[model samples]
Target: MKEKLYTLIIICFTMLLTASCGADHYMKKGEKYLALGEYYDAAAEFKTAYNKTSPKDKDKRGERAKKLAGCYDRINSTQKAIAAYRNTIRYNKADIETHLSFARVLMKNGSYKEAAKEFQLVLDSLPDNELAKTGLLSAQTAQAEKEAGSRYIVKKMDVFNSRRADYSPMLFGDEYDQLYFTSTRNEAEGDELSGITGTKAGDIFVSQKDDKGKWGKPEAIVSGLNTEFDEGACCFTPDQSQMYLTQCTTDPNYPRYATIVTSNRSDAAWGKASALEITRDTLSSYAHPAVSPDGQWLYFTSDMPGGKGGYDIWRVRLTSNGLGGVENLGEPVNTPGNEMFPTFRPNGDLYFSSDGHKGLGGLDIYIAKVDKRTKKFVLEHPGYPLNSYGDDFGMTFEGPHNRGYFSSNRGDGRGWDHIYSFEKPEVIQTVKGWVYEMDGYELPDALVYMIGSDGTNLKLNVKGDGSFTQVISPNVDYMMLATCKGFLNHKEELRVKPVTESEEYVLQFPLASIRVPVLIDNIFYDFDKYSLRPESTKALDELIKLLNENPNVTIELSAHCDYKGSAEYNKTLSQKRAEAVVNYLIEHGIAKDRLSPVGYGKEKPKTIRKKLTEKYPWLKEGDVLTEEFIKKLDKDKQEICNQLNRRTEFIVLRITYGMFDENGNLKNPPKAKEQDNGGSEDDGFVIEM
Candidate 1:
């Protein structure tokens, strides 16, 4: 029995030695593959070593799990990575970055609440970790936004997608009919799979929209653009005559570096591509090139020395002399994380993707608008449908509108990118205007009171430049009044008809001042009578239209006279003249409550302010007209001064337009104006002034 026990012990010792040897061999092999960035083979070997090795050594087991998780993450095996991260934490609970990584993968898997829990765990230990805090906020925000639903209509473009990764869509070609993108499908031109992604290297693919506006099957671009390595992420000049793309050239003994390349289209085929020649730094990577709308700047993503993060968006002047100095986009645009895929709208808004900045999760698209006042970039994330928990980047606009195609890995659990067509619902029709002095500069303190027939009543203040933009619903008629404290209110009428496309209407309010008595040009009364002449119909009709446009306003129609008539007689004549004008307005659909006739019989005469005095150098400011003043002037000048006094003017009395309450609700919601006609009469109204 003693001899049998000894033999059994020797056999058990040999078996343990064999198991230890096998685990060590696999572990070293996995480490070698990991160093080569071959994540697939590295993961397989790591898994074998992990299963064979004893868990008695907690430190080694935890390290192995961590390496396996990293390998899974690089290979796009998110679930396996998450499981491995969890196992690592179970053994080494103090690993803060592992917790953060675990949370990110959880968020990417659409388990936002779970990810938030993990992120909170990291914050519990570090307390002031910005990355962990950002991750927590991102997870919580993503949960809320996803539950709130989406404002955009997003559809996965299956016709342009493949089972493998397909992304970075660009709309180009003569009619914008051809859609070009990067794909890692099995048929890619590359014979070797990428060690970094563990898939076939990226290649350019194009899909053409047929005459019926339907996308056809995608095919490799192949026209000297694709190589055996990686090529994709392209942008074109506004004219689509040139293409700037990213190409990764793999060297056998050296690491692959992403570089920008340029290709020209000739007779519908792309010419030979040439290196973009940014720098000779072998350690740096450059990609994602975009051209400015004016073609004066070339913007691209790079990891050069001066970058604020691992990767940043940079721009260089594209001049006749050659590429100018490189400028980093900096700060809010670039964080301590990667920022890629920079593009532009026709209006010069910069859109890019960043993982360093606070986002929903992973990579999120953000827009940076140059604040005209601060001269700095203001970042904004167009929320919800455009962004998801998964990586969302590589955006391209269809023309200038918000409707376009972007790349996202949202529903794909394997982190495979696919193209999605997104369209914002018909935006509210916008009406913008600027208010200024009639013959002078902008009135910065101007207030724009808007009253829409569709129950829209709001007060908007002008920007520093006296400009105001307000949104209005479709098929609504809006009446806006631009008023200043010392100026007569200006009225504008707009009727927005429902259309399939978004519309922007611009209106200008050139307001006259109350400091001087503005003449009502083209108003002719009968000889020595209050009755309006036939020629005065045009002026009275315009006054009626103004009243209708400013439905909530009340105006005092003041009738004046020249210095010729006696004071008492002129008073009675002017009173009758003002009354007749009010009666005509009431007859032409002007509410009686909106009209107040005042007779300023020669009592109030015209005065020339600094502006008028400059034009009429013979006159000076604070000079009021009387018989003595008019007689002192020349014949031509006397006629001008007298004509200025013999005028009818409507002074804005109240601009509140009883239509709205202080809270913006319509006081007496009138019917949706007769076809958004600014509460006025129909198109065919005969004005008998």
Candidate 2:
């Protein structure tokens, strides 16, 4: 019996030891949770440990302070976190982690200069600490940037958590008074599951600002277009008559992927949803459609083949019928990580969310320029308050106000999803243009189209003045086309796209008319030859008409060669060519200057060609040719290279200007002026032959 009692004592001792170890384990876990930013559970565990600790254990006080400070920081109580951190620093001067944490909290609170000093203290003690160095650099950078002009000041407003809401906010209307966003708020009338979120499905919601500039309560968009499944990321046609939204099936087993769906607004009521055939694909998912203000191109995100990474942004030409084939956005805009939720503001600036590039965390919002010349994207990240260590995405500007909406999952109040407003940087601007007729008149009711080289089409309609304008996006080639009934369509090829403020481009078209004679300005020929040059036929056909019109009028034929060979040889060659032209004209029954033939070789020069081979000190003369040089040139060059030097020309030297009587006999003859020699007084004509 005594042995059994001893055994019972040992068992109780082991049980007490195990309970103590369990409590310590939980305390350690609480500390780890604080580090990982999971504050709610950490607070509970730390509270239990603090209550269990003995009153004399002074270390417990410091532990409680540190844990509570972390909880406050996670909840965005910056002031309280600062005080707690200060207390911990005072009590535990040797804890480097506490000092670093305090500095980080200070930085978050906008006390950047103070944060820099704290980081410097840590770095001085541990010179090779990478985190300390990084913290110091960031603090210094923030301090410096504060001195620069604040082009954008990001302000985090109230955290929105309307019962399971998922945000993808966008701005609509010229004044930005209305905001449209995608959400899965339980209040949605349909109350369906969103397959993408694995929760209550998404529906379009709208919020409006009151006269006082305060946002009104969000209300579901009660249109025929709102579906039970996901519907988000919408863009308006230039006329605002049609709305395009990205729709994804709620069922994962569904074969069809995300697609661009359209709805027509007629008489203020939305019509049934219709998928854009050109943009939809069974094999690929397409979402986040952004239409330019003019509706020329449709920019969106896709996971289609050939993309750089997950869901790279792409574009397609928008036609009256639908969207064109998709083209990938390459380079800096797309990375090996997921890029989604692209939006184009009225001013041509692009905002999107990306996990492909370096960012604060998860999916951070990024801005980039569309380089029209290089056909590539260049990305820029908004630091600090504009971005946080959470998924920040789906941004849209509110016109020139510099205010915008974006979604984030930062701070501890709400779980991982909500919409927030921030101020946009002012470095970006918008481009605008118009469409007109060839007669310089506007074409009302005409459609203006702009297509990115990558196949994104933005569409717009012509106003009463036949004018159309759209914010020009950066980094994409624009193929602009203007179309209207009863007018010949016109197209302008813009190789490099611009991101400048309000660029104006005019496109004109001529009304279709009967085909008329148009001059051909381009032609080429061989040297001193009577035969038709390869390109000469392109122009000769137009000339044939004048011959057919005035058969009675005669024209003089002349040919002159540039100086390059012997004068006698050149003269003879020119004369033969001139005579050959005269013979051909007579055969065609065209009275040349009543057909006079002349050849002024070597005597008359069209252009003075300097003798570069000649000696002249301090002068480096370039090659020059006069009529005199034609005869001195080598046979090969004289016959070929001198093609520009030798060519056929004509002058209307005479015409039978008389009217015929009723009996077909000339009743009166017009007086004629005597023709001068085929030479200008400045340069006497001499037929070498």
Candidate 3:
């Protein structure tokens, strides 16, 4: 609660007051409270000083106005900030930063065009300034962002909200039905208001769902947890046994610095709280603790030294005995601007709030996903509604689901943070596999063994029609193998890509039969020609890969023809076309000994299978496409039968071809031998498109 509004406001107050010691009594007292980061006390005292200052004293009046504006901005008093900054700019336009500061307030007030003009004015002098550039971009974006909506549907959760601030919601338990948050309502244990916020110090509160999933009334914890000091922003361990929260203790003489505290949770109630000593850097502030999903690291925000700027997210290796090395999550996670309130999804995707990156104003939430290649976190702005000109932070997800709760101050004119529930209706990631026999149909008895680099090993059984759907984590590489008796295992590898919307990855497992020939679809040839078509490259490449996967197997590559062609003509054309496929394979890397070319012209007919029958309802299962059967059909049906008969296929000649030699010993495991190409790439004649 007490952060930028406090820590930053105090520094501004200290720099502004160089006036005489004999200045008004109100001014002197206000300066004292301001230096101590007491925002509420400082604002009250400064108002008295401002009213009493004479209009004739432009020099002194402008200084007081600037001081008041800085405080108002921190306290999130939009109208007050605007009025005060306008007054100060009227007298102190000499300060370009003042214009930039005023423009930011205009942005928060939704005066985008006005904000753009102010930013352009700042840029008129400091053309290359980063802040001014960002301000102009944000102003333009806010205008468009107004009409843009993301997939997320957010609803204000007023069930546990109070007139005062209720923020930092935490979801726990098996069903994520238990809700915990922090509030500064009158119901808080403290009788006195905080000097920083002018409200009762925040205390941890809880709300639970009934059998019907409706949340009951929320109650503040009055036991050993709540004290006169402010406490909020809590996260639980992976097991939900221990809670880490942020607490701010008051010292009348020293500036308030936030620290992280831990509390043990028993059957129902939380027990005594203790300070979690992250480091001995007492001069710095440590707050907003978020434990990593694997429970190996503790992530938090700090103004501690070695940070990129205002506040940066940092973490320490969590160990049984004590904390290990600490490191700041450097840019792009950390920027020259503030980044705080780090949280995580069950899949380990990092979520944090920041004003540092390009976003829709104050502390927009961003997701950081590790790149599979570089393995470094990259930022993604989730877009508007989930973000606004007002501050939005503190996100809590309900397990792996895209639905969850976060805290925002978007609609609250007083800038009081409240809880809101958010759900991404269709942002799911899954892998669907169709396990079946190659050139045949679905293998209902097949089972797939899924293996992942993340140590995921699962036995996924295919459905009655040989399909299996499994939820997959983003950025994981999975290897799946379909297994069934009398069939060679068909393996598929997939690396799921990360996206902001729902995505389904489809894979086909056509397990080759141990006895029958497997037809390679999509391999076509020109009319009455032997050369392979360019469109046939993909299917040919897949066949090459299949042969390499089942290395020991040697296959007979054959081509067939319909009864219309003379036997002599069909045999010669089919043999040459079959050799074209063999030469292409050999030229690409397959050995000649592993492939045998044959032309079964009009001799072998086609047999309709379940999949083919489904596609052609007129064709019955087990029906044979013989010459007489096709002669009796309609022209269209007869053509379909001829196309089915004219095909390319491969049959396994031996599974142990290279397994043993004549001496019954492993043939010194032959290295892949490069085959000779009948023609060179430069030797081919170019074909016009």
TM-score of each: 0.62, 0.44, 0.62
Better of 1 and 3 by lDDT: 3
RMSD of candidate 2 to the true fold?
24.2
Q: Per-residue CA lDDT of candidate 1, range 1-689, in tens?
A: 99999999999889877877898899998887777667887898899988877777677678889989989876667889988998898888437878888887787787888999998999999998776787788877876776676678888988988889999999875346888999999989958777667789999988999999988999998677788888999999755678999998765455567889999988879887998787667678899999987577899999989998679999987866778778898888987678999998755799999876767777888999998778899999877778887789888876546778999988777879999999877554677798988656789888777787766656665755677666577777777878788876678888888867777789999776655444567888887899988898897886676566557667788899988879999999999999998999899998898888889889988766666777788888789988799999889999999887888987767767686888998786545434553232332321111
C-alpha lDDT score of every prediction, in listed order: 0.81, 0.62, 0.84
Give the local distance difference test score of model 3.
0.84
Report the Cα lDDT for residue 602, model 3. Answer: 82
State, as a TM-score between 0 and 1, how close model 2 is to the true structure. 0.44
lDDT for each residue of candidate 3 in 383-471, tens digit (9 for 90 to 100)? 87888888888899875678899999887788789999998876788888898888677887887888887777666656556887777
Sliding window of 10 residues with minimal summed lDDT for model 3: 680-689
Q: Output the lDDT of residue 126, model 3.
A: 96
Number of clashes found in candidate 3: 0
Off by over 4 Å in 2: 1-151, 156-161, 191-198, 210-214, 252-256, 278-283, 372-375, 412-415, 425-689
Tens digits of lDDT, candidate 2, 393-475? 87877654457778776663343467887875544433344554332345566765667756565555654455554544466
**Candidate 2, residue 513: lDDT:** 13
